[model samples]
Target: MDGKKKNLTTSWGAPVGDNQNSMTAGARGPVLIQDVHLLEKLAHFNRERVPERVVHAKGAGAHGYFEVTNDLTQYTKADFLSEVGKTTPMFIRFSTVAGELGSADTVRDPRGFAVKFYTEEGNYDLVGNNTPVFFIRDAIKFPDFIHTQKRHPKTHLKNPNAVWDFWSLSPESLHQVTILMSDRGIPATFRHMHGFGSHTFKWVNEDGDAVWVKYHFKTEQGVKNLTEEVATKIAGENPDYHTEDLFNAIGNGDHPEWTLYVQIMPIEHAETYRFDPFDVTKVWSQKDYPLIELGKMVLNKNPENYFAEVEQATFSPGSFVPGIEASPDKMLQGRLFAYSDAHRYRVGANHNALPINRPRNEANTYQRDGQMRFDGNSGDSVYYEPNSQSGPTESHQNKQTGFPVSGVAENIPYDHNDHYTQPGDLYRLMSDDERERLVNNVVGAMKPVESDEIKLRQIKHFYKADPDYGERVAKGLSLPVPQNV
Candidate 1:
């Protein structure tokens, strides 16, 4: 044995006598239950995997830093963006939203673009997606909408019928559905696509003045996408294409970077906006609120261990810093609790204790151990506030400003919303070639649906958006265009 080598031992630190063979009464006889090493090894092996995420299971992550490119101290008090040239360490996870752990990376799906910034104050997670608008506006429909995107329970296969059925019924999905069926659905590589913090967020300045904001991360690599045929071919040939592309690019020192921009809307303007400002399904027009250049985010390092870092790293929009706070976006509100709850259930009660999820700055809490309490259980620090001991206390300066609220809380549907306007506007804005591709893609996807009613219903939504858009899809599907529609 090499003198420098350490002996292998059980988890309890007992040296193993023999690992190749299990203890037994005699050769080929009944195995002895007293073999603690064998029991320990088998038990651990049986529990090797944690439960996979319900969504965005397949993904790639990298470590990097975010550097402020422009001064935005007047807009937000977030310390990481306190001044131009200030840099903060961060981790980013790019993922396919609807795919399983083993699914193809190039599939036509919205990609999740979540970033966790290890700021001076705390970890601020900006959880978002590749698209600025989502399929549905409210969180209540989220589970049902996601169900349609996944494999059927009984058939255990991709169900186009379910997808189209859901989209046809949920007219608000038209904008996102149109984008999904377009060339941009399958990004050529993670580095070539844009990312958006879909929900409206609040940014408070040092003077306590606040504004509504939306975040956009424009890729420095230039937007590129795979055609439908090419994406399908690549999906068959190499399912891990996107994951490998990101890993190799960073490995070769060709780090991917994105310019961060924010669309700032004054607090008063939100109440009188043409559309619901807080709606995740709608986007703030660039004309009204132009993009303000904020900073740059570059992924420069790969994770040392995939499972320990990438797989275990969790993010929550609730992880806000001093200047940032949640908006009234219904989906964002639900996710504030849902994300942290999912992490607790899947990872552990002490999921925050994981090295990757742990904050860079010191963390103080009245909470104590549940499981995997690794930090000496806070070293006998007082676990309750208002104690005689000098325990951690909250700062009034950091408290969020309160706003007036007067509403009869009830299950209110946004039935009064004009969902077709933006989607129609979007269709008309596309180039001739883009519109043709969009029509062809929609027709191709809708063709697999078994129900003609669902197809026609969805086509009607297209027609409502743009006459030409509906007419083209109707022609492609070889269906008659409804006179009234």
Candidate 2:
């Protein structure tokens, strides 16, 4: 027994011997208040779990490197893309948006493909999803839309009526709904799917030229998805299948990789474009703006501690480097505030100070002193602005060219409503079998709806997209087919 240094201490560093038993009276009475160790452990244990994220709660992450494959310094001044073959360390998190933290990994929902590049400039988080377009375009409807996707509070079960009722009312969601009902809705694995920065972001150059851009992470493994039948079987057999697959794949030296691509829209073209550039519900035509290869990402390392590295990590769209800036996309604009706010609420005010979220580059912000100030209050520096003695100041060299904005500042929806064109094009492009499955998926979900009116109205929207689509779903549901009604 090498008991030379066998002792334990409380948080205050006082050595204690009887940690196995609480200090109590007569070995049967309530524990003494002087048992600070017991008190501390119990209190901390009670608050061990923080609030789970409202969406994208079920996920996995890995450490990796993003190496530039091609130089695109002419388009944007983001340092990560400045030089070819330059490798920057990054952390990526892949998640299912609709499921709770303990939910099955094979659920039919969009997977979040978010990455944080730890570059010299700072941490730049590209918050994206596996799908190119989202259900809602405006940030104001985000909470409401998310509520419909979640389980019904009273029944504690998934409600298709709640889902379709909201989706049917909001026509902008039609495009995404089509994709969700298709084969891509349930990805075969995290490696076999594409990730998209669905919102258009403004990228500025050193010369102050601005262009709108969307990020695409095309999986080098190729896109593969499971049929509904297979997905259901896998879900019941292994609810944590995806998470286990990702961890074991990385651990077994088989790294998953993705190629980074960007589609840029010139500032001039955005003004004259047929649809609003900021509408997230619709995607820009790939034929018009081709993808420009930028880099490659490879996840090579799994975290030693899941909760510390993965669960504690926070990614916000607002976190941008010098050349990258937020656009006027309403959903993106709302996420700028909502993400950080949620993190703070869940992980305390200094959530960024966590090792996972902290930037590798030095941060000299005026923000200081909150809960979990692990970095020792920045060693007694000035927390206020306008200091004379080399306290970090704003940069004019990294200024972004701002476009002029005019109009009454009020809540307004985007003027464009051409939702059918894209969905129709998508429906037409699908193979016959794929289309049949999509219709079956839609009807299978829609059939259990208690309200006939919602079903009819939604079928009408589908009918507007393509008569075949509407008729197929109608037939599956045994609803009267609309013969040009």
lDDT leader: 1
* Per-residue alpha-carbon lDDT of candidate 1 for residues 1-485, written as tens digits (9 for 90 to 100): 56798989999898999999999999986999999899999999998889989999999999999999999899899999999899999999999999899899999899999999999899999999999999998888989998998899998998999999999999989889988988788899999999999999999999999999999999999999988999999999999999999999999999999999999999999888999899888999999999999999999999999999988999999999999999988889889998999999888888888999999999899889887788788886888989989998999999987777887899977644777899898888889988888888888888989988988898899999888888899899998886786
lDDT of each: 0.92, 0.91
| Candidate No. with top TM-score | 1
How would you encode candidate 2's per-residue C-alpha lDDT over 1-485 as one tens digit per residue? 87797568877788877878989887696778988889998998998778888899999999999999998888789888789999999999999998899999998999999899999999999999999999999889998999998889999898988999998899889999999999999999998999999999998887888889999999999899999899999999999989999999999999999999999999889788888889998888889899999999999999999899989999999999989999989999999999999999988899988999988888888888888898988787877889876899989897666779999989777888987878888999999999999999998899889998999888888888888888888889888777664
Candidate 1's TM-score reads 0.98
Candidate 2 clash pair list: none
Candidate 2, residue 78: the lDDT equals 89
| TM-score for all models, in order of appearance | 0.98, 0.96
Q: Lowest-scoring 10 consecutive residues by lDDT in candidate 1? A: 412-421
Question: What number of clashing residue pairs does each candidate have, in the order they appear?
Answer: 0, 0
